[model samples]
Target: SDTLTDQQKKCVAPNVYSLAQAYLNSEQAWPRAIYLGETPIGFIMLDIDPEDIDKKENAYYLWRFMIARDYQGKGYGKKALDLIIDKCKEDQKSVLYTSCDMEEEMPYRFYMNYGFTDTGVFDDDEKVLKLQLI
Candidate 1:
């Protein structure tokens, strides 16, 4: 929450503290904290579907991700994304998926640069990118 600006806090609303507390308590979700050197920068939440686990065909999904506004540029997003890839690969996930707003060109390009391809789109305003680990 410290990373969020006042306006960002409003957008997320009342659930901010509750969600953060709940997320911290959930081991299955496997949330990770991202840091820029020694300063904590953001959080990434990764989840694997329980049903798909038995077949080893799950897609690792990024549930939440945010980097402080001050950390937006200067290559931090790419480094954070690389961390996601490394974490997912370590978990043996067959693929990973994430959605980005069309207006946010950075995230779209970031996913593309990391070898993620557009696999689906929702509401014609966002794109879903997938990276097959296999």
Candidate 2:
């Protein structure tokens, strides 16, 4: 939480607090801390909602992701994302979904560069994006 600035915090929720709330609310949410060696650097969450199970395409959402301000631009975010994609592939997931505030420059561009395409879907004012894993 202290890794982000006030502006960044506004764009993304505090990781520790959000993770606690997510776990308390649903067993489907999986949260993980991003670590480099022994140092904590960021956080990510993946969710597989019941509604997602009903979809024709099998996918999981990249529910939340944030790299610390100091850690940004160091290639850690990209490497972490690659690991997440690999995990989904191992689980036989064909697609990975995520949504980000359109106004948030970092996440919007980062996801795009990482091959997530806009899906023309929105949730709570955020633009949805999807990556085809297969």
Candidate 3:
């Protein structure tokens, strides 16, 4: 299937079925996907206070976030971000940060529009951004 390559399909089959259980049971970090009805729309893996990942003072990482091809351009990305931000606010977290490939125009602008400031670049092609919550 175009959604997943053969090797990826095989590798992720079990994890897909146990996604929720794994996410909820995880002791280290949050790795989750957002769904629309029964369809998986996107995934977000984050850490509340990750160690070793260098960041500005008082910031946490929203490590990975990706919307599926069919779900792109539908504003679901913004909604997912809103959900995450709301959760952070509820938990009294002060700052949130993420990194995106600089070559990708949409995500870079999206983060900027949503109030993230470009802090620096890393991984040769990724730009890091930050948002401070009040």
Clashes of each: 0, 0, 0
> How well does each candidate superpose onto the true structure, as a TM-score?
0.70, 0.90, 0.74
Please report, as a residue range, the 10-residue window in candidate 2 with the lowest summed lDDT: 48-57
lDDT of each: 0.66, 0.84, 0.70
Q: Model 2 segments beyond 4 Å from truth?
A: 50-54
lDDT (10s digit) by residue, model 3, range 1-134: 35533433332233354455447646646777789989887777677666745544555578666666677778988999999998888877788878776553657888899899998756446677889897
Highest lDDT against the true fold, candidate: 2
Mind giving the per-residue lDDT tens digits that candidate 1 earns over 74-94?
Answer: 788778878888877887778
- Candidate 1 Cα errors over 4 Å, as ranges: 1-18, 21-27, 50-56, 104-106, 123-125
Q: If both were scored by TM-score, which would come out higher, candidate 2 or candidate 3?
A: 2
- Please name the candidate that would achieve the greatest TM-score relative to the true structure: 2
Name the candidate, 1 or 2, with the larger TM-score value.
2
The C-alpha local distance difference test score for the whole of candidate 3 amounts to 0.70
Q: Give the C-alpha miss distance for residue 103 in model 2, angstroms.
A: 1.7
For candidate 2, lDDT tens digit of each residue in 20-49? 868785777878889999998999888866
Sequence-dependent TM-score of model 3: 0.74
